[model samples]
Target: MSIFPLDHRPDSSQISEFFQEVRCAAMEFVFPPACMMCRSEMPHRIFRTAGCTLCDDCLGQLDSGHGNACRRCGAPVGPFTIATDHCILCHRENYAFDGVIRMGLYRDSLRVACLMAKNPSGSLMSRTLADLLVDTQYELFSERAFHAVVPVPEHWAKRLIRPHYAAETMARQISARLKVRLATGILAKARWTPKQAKSPPVQRRQQQKDAFHVVGAGVQGQSILLVDDILTTGATADAAARVLKRAGASRVVVAVVAVSPPRA
Candidate 1:
């Protein structure tokens, strides 16, 4: 009897907190976390922000969209501004998503950052990229009140190969930053398709046709934000948006880390 000290036993919450602190300390020792962008050591203040791995200097270097951009697709238009709402691509091709908010053109440092974030070993960098996206596109996000944030679903085979899908991880970070619900498993890839980067515009659409479908019930009448790593042809976004709309989503907006320039 009385082997245990009943008066001094920690509650479950206290025990959980203690374990969490111990785990964090262990991780810090093992990983010795550094800035994702500049590879500098993360200071204490910067570490307080969840998934923040960018040093202040590197964070300031993020390239956000500038000049005249098409309102519908967020593509940069010519110097002599004409219509702000629609670009030639927007007029020629019909997209399912209502609008797009892109962080920057796919070039230079932004391109390098995107490639790095896609690497399987770059989970921390992926989180940092998400934080960057949130920081740069805060104004765009604040313009709309989305019901949920969903990442463009990766196929099961792809998921097994990489394990941590960059888009999904980025979506999680963005959802947290936006205080929106992160909805997963609602959209699924029906079949694997070849990469769209090299495919012609028409082929890109054909390859992605009926490739995605929606599951579950929460999407009905919800305004959804679909997150993706890149927006090249806009075909993939259109395909996914069609399914979401068919599943009763009132509106779908696309957010991506980078957007390719419109074809000549």
Candidate 2:
């Protein structure tokens, strides 16, 4: 004889109540799960605050700076070398952007946040990241120069699949924070390209060459800020800048969450 019979079942109402009780008990047992980065109780309003244990103190300690970086590209300089204002890459080529600035390196917590923002199911954390980016960009770039926010456009197919691009979301947030107009339809992708992550740098540049087109009203003499999640070789931004300049944008400045470290 079995101690518990398969046929023996509790009433639906009782079962529901029992599960609710169990859930409450489980939550109480894990009142504050550790943060993904610092393994401490996360602060309020954080996307994964419940699951993250990181406290305010730890979050405050995160490193965020260009660190004697390139004036144009914002790439960090080496410690031993005498700090030059611009990186070698920027010096080699003239870019459409008057300048660029980034909030933090593309590592650790920022990396996790970027991944979360890309997935459709990660909307909660993605929104948090967008808020952070907007706040940071407003604080960092307001003193410089920019009249509007232009998020790099996603190709039609990608937009159809994942309509919410983090850059566009961030642009909207930044626009509100700075009280500037958000002009999203100014740039359009002419063609859908393969993922840039796996493509070699040369191929990536070539892929974006004829990819973006400027549409709608021209920016004319206004300085525009192009927002994106990451800047690898600066090719994509370069392409976008070409289109914007052709459309009469006075200037184009690139702003991103991360810029890939120099190729080895």
Which candidate gets the maximum lDDT versus the true structure? 1
| lDDT comparing candidate 2 with the true structure | 0.71
lDDT of 1 by residue, 46-117 (tens): 245644566666665665435556768979888798776677768876889999887778876678788888
TM-score of 1: 0.81
Tell me each candidate's TM-score. Answer: 0.81, 0.74
Residue 50 in candidate 2 has what lDDT? 33
Whole-model lDDT, model 1 = 0.83
Residue-level error in angstroms, candidate 2, position 153:
0.5
- Error in Å for residue 173 of model 1: 0.6
Q: Find the candidate with the highest TM-score and give its number.
A: 1
Candidate 2 lDDT, 1-264, residue by residue in tens:
013357878777767776775675467457745454456654343243432234555455433543555658868777654745467777877666667767666666677667766777655455555555555656557676678889989987888888577778767766676677899888899998888898887898899897999887668887998888788888899899988888888888887777786776
Clashing pairs in 2: 34-52, 34-53, 35-52, 35-53, 40-53, 40-54, 41-53
